[model samples]
Target: MNTNKSGPQENIDLGNSKVVNIRDKFDNKTKEILAKRVGYLCSNPDCKNTTSGPHTDPKLTINIGVAAHITAASPGGPRYDSSLTPSQRRDSSNGIWLCQNCSKLIDSDTNYYSKDLLQGWKHNAENHAKQLIERELNQGWATTLPEYFESLISLELTTSPPIGRNIGQSSDGQFWLVLWDSRNAKYQWSKITEKYAEQELQSVCKYRNVTNWQDLFEK
Candidate 1:
């Protein structure tokens, strides 16, 4: 005497159903963009797992990644923001790339992984991907120096008694010495040669009494 229809049904109410679960899911384009922006790596800094690889089938590939929502796609979900609209919730800006495990972990423990923290991870992951792409395009010349050198340049420009100076090579294989002088409140770039790069950087560090300058580049 039981009659229940099986197959795709449009919001079938089974007696106790008072509410419908509607999720603002991302479209295929948004998912692909999110994956590419992070280079298909997990956004979790501690767990940057490669999420894509080749499958046994030559034409097929296995993807263990997901475009996870920074804020929940629906109400009562993890990190749900009441302020965001339906369109905003499904936008690429609200997405982050993560592996299956990390996507589940973030949802399971929303307290530890707040909205801001996830946003930071997304920002960093995107930046890392950009740097990688730049390096590849420039034939590795874009990353001749430690990545921290870029941040150091910015820090030295605003601080007193500038101590950050380094020599970097350009994409065209030309070397240049970058110097920051706090007295003038300006930085200067002078052309130099590859052989003098290390020597000049060391000399500048020594004059500035930066004994542990190498630590600046440590991860």
Candidate 2:
């Protein structure tokens, strides 16, 4: 007779005190939440590695982020928690987003990565993403031409849309134009004078949309 009590199959025990072929799997919803919550970046503070990027195939993207459990999903595994229910084991709150390398490293060095420490990492990563989004929103529109260009690139990696608009005079006092792309929401800007930039931006709002050039300056 199998003495092992029934539970999630991932940590099942065979007869005669033998535990074999255990597995713990996170549901698709849990996986999605873990990845999205951390902005698809590795949760390691020192690494801060990008988990997804443009792939060699132009039409494809690569994702390397892993949702690793804070406590092992199965018995006899690193940081294994026999006390947790199967549902609790697979919860998003019990997971952390990590790069492939960091995932292996944590599991191998279980002594250093306690459940509490992994929870702290998760908290920090999510808070970091939230702060970046807040900064982008609070920045409003860029006031100067140079500031506009810089802000556009700086915000591309964060959760914000990274859309910025600016109209200002340059050092030479030429009219500066910065437009947001309606199709893709990309920030488009040019250092050339107003006449040259009109053709480049190809804006539908060119002549009919403006009250006055002087009134367009973004603060």
Candidate 3:
């Protein structure tokens, strides 16, 4: 019925009795940090929709993003870890920004959206935000798709590669490809024409069955 700075306080009815459901929800500050870190984008790589936009009222803004918990905020919830304390549950590190749909999707399916997977998504999303900021500071505009593939190749070499493939890029501003071998943790890359980069990216996307090529850059 009443809420405080700590978290939400509510009562739930069960049969003939009422019980309190005190979830360790993120505070306003924590939610802001999570949203800012991801540049207000949904952390789901496949669904990187912008979560905030202008409203008809100049004084107001609309937000469709949710600061979701990586681990459940309460008992018997999806990915709930009893080992975590209430403070830990409410911490920013345990939160991920997502659209309303994705927030519900993750909670509904715990097996496919494991804690590790969500963590990965958070890391990638934050890194993407950082890169975007850095790119704007270093250059005037966002990196072109080909340049993005080139950076992916560089990222692959520095970290874990995908599976069963070797990748490369070209200097002629043509194209690039990157492969990740999760088993061996090895990466192979080369330079090719821009046309080849598109083809290779399509091939890799098909292999991984992912709609977004940016998902491949996940470490």
Best by TM-score: 1
Off by over 4 Å in 3: 1-20, 140-219
Candidate closer to the true structure by TM-score (higher is better), 1 or 3: 1
**TM-score of each prediction:** 0.66, 0.55, 0.61
Q: Report the lDDT tens digits of candidate 3 across residue range 127-189.
A: 899767855664432332323444453333334434544444344343434444455443334
The residue-level lDDT of candidate 2 at 214 comes to 39
Q: What's the CA RMSD of model 2 in angstroms?
A: 12.7
Better of 1 and 2 by lDDT: 1
Displacement of the residue 57 alpha carbon in candidate 1, Å = 0.4
Q: Give residue 28's error in model 1 in angstroms.
A: 1.3
lDDT tens digits by residue: candidate 1, 138-195: 5443332433333231233334554356565555555566655555444445577656
